[model samples]
Target: MPDARDKAPLLGLGLVWQQLAVGQRFRSFGRTVTEHDLMGFVALTGMQEPLFVDATHTGALGPRPVPGALTHALIEGLLLRGMVHGTGLALLETHIRPLAPVRVGDTIHAEVEVTAIRPTSTGGRAVVACAVRVRNQRDEAVMDYDVTRLLRGESTP
Candidate 1:
């Protein structure tokens, strides 16, 4: 008898590795940054940097900068519903560059582009490289990065 925890979800069959293509681009739905989101990130990741946690702390740098990693996660969450929509196999790596500051009430969107693809040596999976850019409501880039994900495929006999 299989436990419920061991069962895969109904949508488990994501886009197969072979169905992916390089140069494809996706735009994620917009998400607005909030105080709760920022604070929750502090609680979730133990990131208590003043730039993100200190409400009154403001400098020439603009509103307390939203944690870069949090921004990345939120923007990526939007992508997951559409751009990165699929049963993800694994996140191989993420390289991020914080370009600008994000603050409360800022609406953000992600632009994801498939950069490269290669089959795993076993021929049952593939590694996909994607370039992601997160932009604020002002149309300014807040963060940019590249992520590599492993995609599942049909099993070989």
Candidate 2:
């Protein structure tokens, strides 16, 4: 029989601050945007703009254009599930830019590249900056953003 030390862990854990290096790149699993997602987001957030809530609001973009904020949130959720679940301390800053319209039923994923890493003066924590590009199933760049987050170090402070 195998002992606990010889058994492999089943759950995936987030990376600590020291494990990340500048210029390191990571890819997140894809998530598909469905009509239910749009509806729930619109109702929950009260974003009742015609572009999101109106089914017949047709414009130059498309008939079913979802909000850029929703896309960003979905990407962040993906990252939280895949990369930074427990080791991430807090979200310090985020700068977002929408490049293209994302409609319902489009599967999206994020490509993240670490831009910088700086250790804090007090605790054994570090701030990590990443440049993220969101792409749809068709391989089109739909959004771009830069996010800064605080992550815990390997040892307790």
Candidate 3:
């Protein structure tokens, strides 16, 4: 007979190959340098700096800068919902950075690769790891993050 300790759920792992393999190219939401998205960021942060929302200030920069945090959120959104929503886990870890400016008229796309997956220590959940990125039309990485998620299993009725 199985002991109560031995009745715990078994852990499993899953893998996702290079998203580049899914398609040589992926589409991203379109935006512009002069768009509200940039201004909204400055406003939300309560930043009165002219460089963020002021066109004159941003114009000198060649374009407005998209917050690295927002860019990271975009990358995470693409992976958590757009690409692997069905993975059935909540995010566990996120390490992100923005390397370049994300301006208006730039289309944003993502790249995803599964690194690892397994059950949680409690035996009631699972975990997934993914490499996620959001890039502009030029294919230069504007945002990058490594994400981990917790997967939950079914309960018997």
Write the residue-wise lDDT of candidate 1 on 67-109 in tens digits: 8888988977776665435646778999999998888899999
The C-alpha RMSD in Å for every predicted model, in order, reads 4.1, 2.9, 8.8
Ten-residue stretch with the least lDDT total in model 3: 14-23
| Model 3 Cα lDDT, one tens digit per residue, 1-157 | 7789877844432222222232233333433334676667667878656666665663544666656665665555554444445545456787876667776567777766656656566756657676767778787887776777775544301
Highest lDDT against the true fold, candidate: 2
Model 1 alpha-carbon drift over 4 Å, by segment: 1-14, 83-86, 154-157
Error of 3 at 45 (Å): 3.2
Give all TM-scores, in the order shown: 0.83, 0.91, 0.65
Using TM-score as the measure, the top candidate is 2
Model 1 CA lDDT for position 84: 39
Global CA lDDT of candidate 3, please? 0.58
lDDT of 2 by residue, 1-157 (tens): 8788766754777888898999999999999999999999999999998888888898889889899999999999999887778889999999999999999999999999999999999789999999999999999999999999998888833
